[model samples]
Target: MPLRPVAALAAACTLALLGPSAAAAVALTPLPQSVRESEGSLALPGRFAIAWTGCREPMLERAAERFQRDLGRLTGVETFAAAGPRLEIACAAADPGALSLEAREAYRLQVTGEGVKLDADGPIGVLRGLATLRQLIETGPDGAAALPAVAIDDRPRFAWRGVTIDTARHFMSIETLRRQIDAMEQVKLNVLHLHLSDNEAFRVESRRYPRLHEVAGHGQFYTQAQIRDLIAYAADRGVRVVPEFDVPGHARAMTLAYPELASNPAGAPAAGAQVLNPASEAAYRFVTRLFDEMAGLFPDAYFHIGGDEVGDDAWAGDPQVEALMKTEGLTTKAQVEAHFHRRIHQALTRRGKIVVGWEEIIDTGTLPRDIVVQAWRTSNATARATALGHRTIVSAGYYLDLLNTAQFHYGFDPLDTSAAGMSPADADAARKLHPLVGRFVTDGVVVQPMAPLTPEQEALVLGGEAPIWAELVTDEMLDNRLWPRAAALAERFWSPREVRDTGDMYARLAVQQDRLRRLGLQDQAARARMASRLAPGASEPLLVLLDLVGPVRNMAHDKRVPAAIAGKKIVQNLTAMADAAPVDSLAARAFLARAERAASGEAAARAAVRADFEVWNANHRRVVAIAQDHPAVREALPISADIAEMAAVGLLALDALETGKPLAPETAARAKVVLDRADAFEAASARPIFSFFGKRPPADLIIMVTPGVRRLVEAAGG
Candidate 1:
């Protein structure tokens, strides 16, 4: 089946099919086959040429220059000229054509003047359209360039296309952040959600709270000037800068700034993680100052006061908090949490900006309607918030950092009526429904439902993003975790949904991934390499197999085989014993019994490993089959399965090594290793079954070792 657009695009497509103007609505489609031939190179008709007339911003100038240079390298276009060929490039402040499509946040590129005019809706859009145009001009023989004449009506479905960067986990250099922002513009994403503070550290410089950076940031905080510089840079790309100062929970950094603000009124423990004192006036004042600084620093008119995961137990036990809650008639801990959210929301709103927070803000119930709620929980919450008229953005089940399988991510829908019921479905069929959940919660509520959307969802979405959560993720892992996949998401966000062609994208991805590799990124390359190794007829002995196995367990969060696999070398070495010890004084029967015990133990271990494969593989099949029924699922499910299978196989290999048996002479001699030495190779290549034995199991698990093994075998092209 073909790929499906995200929630927004699906709606748009539905709407397009309704009336007289349906034919004119903008929709995504695959790039013309002729143009998509080259991965990074653009193939243009002989008659087309690109020219730039006016550019004032330094970034724009730099972007244009880079485009020109890349064009030369890829398609052999030494210079851009309006009169030279078929494609013409012109830079102007306004749309030069009488008839052109205008999008809200980006440049408006139009076909005009016997060629095409690059008139961006904004600088960001201009940059993106330029990239597209560049990709269209392909290299010909002897370093020559050409162009094509094609009309495209394009715009993003969302007003806030963004990528959330967790600067607090491990400081990402300003240069790195800026580069990412530049790329975001190229993909037409219009927002940057900077997670500047978290439980790990605080990364923004504040004069009022000098210690925030000095003590909490580990010397990795961004100076105020740096923040301003980033803001300005994003402004040029038509991207808004939204700063997050997570509160209540995830505020260990703040504890360093104001020890009295910790949940423990008695004060913070020596080595325990910090929690905030929601009842303290000082806590309120500190956060207010931070927001005040943020509002002044970021002019996006929307601020994120992270009202997420505030620990109720911490606040409940604090004497100071208890006293305050009693005075306020707050009987429950949830109420106390709500009070904190209300105070922070009020603080930000008073500063002339609306607030956005995780679904917990609503769970707390005191957040005002004007505050934008980001539903990072279940779709049920999304429906609840929207039904109540609050504007919400859904981010549940899409936490990229959680290391879930792609199928798990692909199964849910942002605009799904499953949570809201058949009323909306029937209404949609009747052409009378208008997604009243978000609009009905409150007259002023604006809900933005988001998660780390799949590439297919990106098409149906207003726009999608990749959120980098701090757990198990750091700046070092950023490029690896986000690349190629993130690039796929970016295209889905910018390109029209109808333009989707998976077979074409799969081919294109193969090339784009190489481009990323050449840019000094090997993580994405490793992922792709592992995927190929798992393909049928590919060599299983490739280095990628081992890596693939570990990642599979991480993706599924199933500890059975993976936990065992993690200790393969240890187990293998311990279990692999010499056949029978020649004990001169021992009784014959006793020696035989000892030998039998050893064999039984090894057999049990092998069974355990097999069990893990059974569980994971079965689930994999179910998920893949379910996904096949949904258009969006059908298109994006392969990545998840491929990754899981690789991880599983790798772990199984680790288990095999512990079997204590000699490998076949031919096998031992022929297999080339991906990692580890010859000894490690022998250990890893043993019987891929013993590493899974004897584990405490979860209750009522559906997908067992048998199914997991089968699914992996199938995926690995067994």
Candidate 2:
């Protein structure tokens, strides 16, 4: 019943060559460091064979199987494992030893008419090459599988390209975690930082303390076996799984199960007492044992003991903690926090694991140089940590949970800014005053040029991560929230600094988006399903509205809806058009540009603009009818009507522009009134359900026709 690999390869090659323009180059994501295109191409069959020379590692063999399965899934071809020269995989040397950071992940992939070859230093490099090969496979002009002839030498620019997923806020299933890991591997992200515990829940099962899972986790937690499985899954794809157990603060879940470990006992109303009892010996013992068990599950040497946001009141009202602080001669709450971090650092050190924590730990001034600080709150944290002789990872601008556009995250570079302009006297004085002084320069013309990081400081900057905090995220929204954008972040972490063209990045992203969907990412599909739920009788209007609008950015959703309502379900308060769309305003702007060109005498562009406006104009009636029977549709009816009115007014302005007639004073005034009304409608619709909360800010609405209509009206003196 087994299909021969040679036959599959031959069939794929024959089909690919039959298509026209089979040698066209495919735009690769995370563009290679160096690539040279040739004049031929290799046609891939539905079932292809891989020929290995000196690649015997089990990881490499597993990678080959993955590649075979992925290719079959992508091309609708049934691939088989066999030995042949159709696709040759090999190592550069005879002894391609163990994989590590020191081992080169750089790979050279060469494709020709005869076949394709992938060469790497180790199994890790081979996996990287395979990912590239998967991305390179494209359907030719005649719809057959093909790969353009090219030679690509590629390696990551940073070693710690990562994504931190917070499961504590929202317990994600193991299957979901695996899917995310698969997605991360597609973009070649190297690390998966699992935030395993927080105030809401302790997401990992503790066999040593079974109550931690049964009571603290609310019956939703990953078993130790699941954790190990996830680690192996990540390892096979060249990703390190790092576990984080937040301590001192964000410890309500832990304290719920073991009240004795809490600084303030159950039923006690003490200020700033919602943290682990640093003064309690039992607390330290519990943490040490739990961390040891969790660390043993993850093979990676790095462990994250969350040391962020330990409030000033944390130990203020606790008698025991106050006594301990007094005994230790600690004057400020920060000093107490420092003491707790130092103890944990010492414990982790004894276990032979490197500790990684948030920026608060760096402020402690007690953590050893070996600890890694993750800078999330400020731009200069990475530079500050590195300046102090500690390695650092930047995550401030890379918080994907903020819902910013991909371009915003891509523009943030970990190594771009430094403390080079300050004088030696000022620098030293500033260091004494604050840790971030040398990391960020003040905004203004300076007497001296800004200095780049010293070679040593640069060396200490390990890399960066995109942290996806799951406060408002749900299982269904995870794929849409992470991908396409994470791919962009991946490029930022992998490609050379000079690769900063946002336009080019988006073009490749369009292709990658479809590829991700084909690979089982439900970003687009989820939106469609949500739209159907909103307007089952007529979902097109809802879909059209979403296509032009996106979710408000900068945590605006948090402001517009109550936390209790939003937190209960992902789609509870997400019926607005923007909730299902991405935040990039580029597409609307592009359409406006076309509309402007249409005004300059392009008939087809003019027709296109008119057709789109007509659709929006007609959508209002359909939405109104649907809302009559559908409560969900009614919820978004106000914005829907406003969009329709904007489109109708846009059509009027377009007519005047095409007629080359100046608008009368009265007509112009009426046009302005219509525009103002549309704006007011948008503002009113965005108000929170609880109006007593205060005056709501105007919604971050992206009306596609606004620019085009404004241009037409201004030309007509309206």
Judged by lDDT, which candidate is best? 2
- After superposing candidate 2 on the true structure, give the runs of residues whose Cα lies further than 4 Å from its correct spot: 1-25, 76-85, 93-100, 265-273, 418-452, 559-579, 583-609, 649-718
lDDT score for residue 646 of model 2: 63
Evaluate model 1: give its TM-score. 0.61
Error (Å) of candidate 1 at residue 339 is: 1.7
Report how far off residue 249 is in candidate 2 (Å): 0.8
Q: What is the lDDT of residue 51 in candidate 2?
A: 82
Model 2 whole-model lDDT (C-alpha atoms)? 0.71
- Write one digit per residue (lDDT tens) for candidate 1, span 1-718: 2222343333443344222333332222212211211112233323244455654456566666666555444543445432344334444454322111133334444432255566555455566676556544434455565443344434554444466788887688877777666555544556678898887789988888888889888889899899999888776655678888888788888887667667774554613356677777887898888779768877767788787765445664568887997799988877888888888878877888878777677767555777766655445556555654566555554455544323333344454423321233332332322232222222112223334433443333223345766544445445555444445555544554454544334334434444334334545443344333333233222222222222221222223334434543222210000101110101222222222322244444344445533554554565465544433233324433543453355344434445444334433322222112222322321211211222211210111112233322232223
Q: At residue 54, give the lDDT of candidate 1.
A: 56
Report RMSD for candidate 2: 8.3
lDDT of each: 0.50, 0.71
Report the C-alpha lDDT of model 2 over 133-197, residue by residue, as the tens digit: 98888776566677777788888888888999999877788888888888777888888999988
Candidate 1 segments whose C-alpha is farther than 4 A from its true place: 1-63, 73-103, 106-115, 122-124, 140-143, 265-273, 404-413, 417-464, 491-505, 514-550, 553-718
Best by TM-score: 2
